[model samples]
Target: MKVGVVTFPGSNGDTDCIETLKLVEGCEPQLIWHKSTDLMGADALILPGGFAHGDYLRPGSIAQFSPVMREVARFAASGGPVLGICNGFQVLTEAGLLPGALLRNQYILFHCAWTHVRVSSNRSPWLEGVEEGTVLRMAVAHGQGNYFADTETRRRLVEQGQVAFEYCDPEGNTSGESNHNGSVDSIAGVTNEAGNILGMMPHPERSSDPLLGSADGRVLFESLVRSMAAGAVGR
Candidate 1:
């Protein structure tokens, strides 16, 4: 699978995502600049974590206008698999590819630490084949990763099984304390209605190797590869 990792001006996680993709069997990664519209015929797309345009105005405010994002949006509308991590999550929301917004951390701090997230939904191609309630170990580094949505939207996400990941304990239990960043309903990640696009705060790219920490994140990446091989994309 050819995965395109988008790199906005201030994107710092593109290298990490690319390196991780290189390690995933059968994953071919291509670095994409924010200015380019050509997708290079990528099988999947990844908007890496970073402070695009220094996160000026808002986390993804500026980056949303990038030319590449138009292409990204187009691909997403076609049901292509797209994963947005951290700032990428913000961008997805801002671009209207996904619902909700990433507000500033409630405590007003740049929270960086490993967190436990349980799979709330695996309907998306990105998390396809991942069992619900499976706890995953991933790291989050962001100052504005608190996910928020309207009351109705939140309820819909839950009822529709679009809540992809939720902060939880190692045992797969969620609580106020377990929900880092105070995201509503412990939402660490969510997928679009069609389930092809996902916006997540955790950095799975950084957790692909046990040397760095837990390799739990590798499961999601591998899931994508497996789903694609099975011709289950755009689901």
Candidate 2:
């Protein structure tokens, strides 16, 4: 698998994503520059987290207009597997690839902490082997990681099984204080209608290694690799 990680002007998580991809056998990771239009034959693409363009004009608003994002949009439209982390999720929403927008944290603070997210849906290959309600420990670092969508859209996402992950307690309780960012329905991640593209606020790449306090995030990458080996579609 050739996994490409796009590096925007201020993106800081590209290297982390590359290293995480390297941990998976048969995975060749490529670091693509934001100015480059070509994805270099990537089987999957990751838009890692960071304050792209210094988060000017509100999070990903400026970065979404970068030259490479045009190609990213095209690749996603073709059913290619695309994963967007924090700022990347903001970019996806700004680019209209994902349904909802990311708002600033309800507490208006840049939160950096370990969080537990439960696998909420199996509609995408990214969760192929992860059982529903399985809690994964990951780190979330962002000021605008809160997810927001209109009521109808939220309902549609749930009904269509597009919800991928939800902020929850270690025991898989999604209510109350588990939702630190105050995201609607505690949504930590969600997939596009076709389940090929995933946008989430958590940094799974950062939590993929044992040295990172938790290896729970490995399940997602492992599942993706297995899915690819089995010739599974993102759907």
Candidate 3:
């Protein structure tokens, strides 16, 4: 599998994401600059976490207009798999590739720590093959990781099974302090209607290796690889 990792100016996790894809998934990593339109024939796309354009215009607001995003948007519209993490999540929202918006943390502070998120749905190719209700230990580091959508959109998201992951306790209870960001309905991740694009605030690349404290995040990447391979066979 060939995975394209976008690297915007000030993107800090581009290398980390590249390493994760190569080491964890044994996939070829293609570093795509924010200014380029080429996708290098990548089968999967990853928008890793980082302060794009230094987050000068509020998180992903500035990065959304980059040249590369146009192709990314096109790729997603054609049913390509796209995964956005942290700042990437914000970018996806800004690019109109995903629904809802990421707001400031409820505590008005940057949250940086290991957190648990339960798989709410496997309808997305990114989460396919992963058992529902499984608790994944991943690290989240961001001030604007809170996910919110208006009442109507929220209802539709739930009804359509677009909600992919939710902040939850180790035992899979999604209530109270388990929601570190105070996101509405404890939402941690969501997928597009077509289930090919996913946006989430957690850093899955950080936890893909057991030596990094946990290997739970590998489940998502593995599922993505499996789904891509299956798609190739079907084609």
Go through the candidates in order and give each one's C-alpha lDDT. Answer: 0.92, 0.89, 0.90
Task: Give the clashing residue pairs of candidate 1, or none.
Answer: none
Instruction: State residue 226's C-alpha deviation in candidate 2, in Å.
Output: 1.3
Deviation (Å) of 125 in candidate 2? 2.0
- For 16-97, candidate 3 gives per-residue lDDT tens digits of 8887887755588889999999999988899999899999868999999999999999989888889999999999998889
Clashing pairs in 2: none
* TM-score of model 3 (CA atoms): 0.97
User: CA lDDT of 113 in candidate 3?
Assistant: 96
Error of 3 at 138 (Å): 0.4
Off by over 4 Å in 3: 232-235
Write the number of the candidate with greater lDDT, choosing between 1 and 3.
1
lDDT for 122 (candidate 2)? 75
Give the residue spans of candidate 1 off by over 4 A.
none
* Candidate 3 least-lDDT 10 residues: 226-235
Query: Once superposed on the true structure, which residue ranges of model 2 sit more than 4 Å away at CA?
Result: none
lDDT of 1 by residue, 132-169 (tens): 88999999899998999999999999899899999998
Worst 10 residues of 1 by lDDT: 226-235
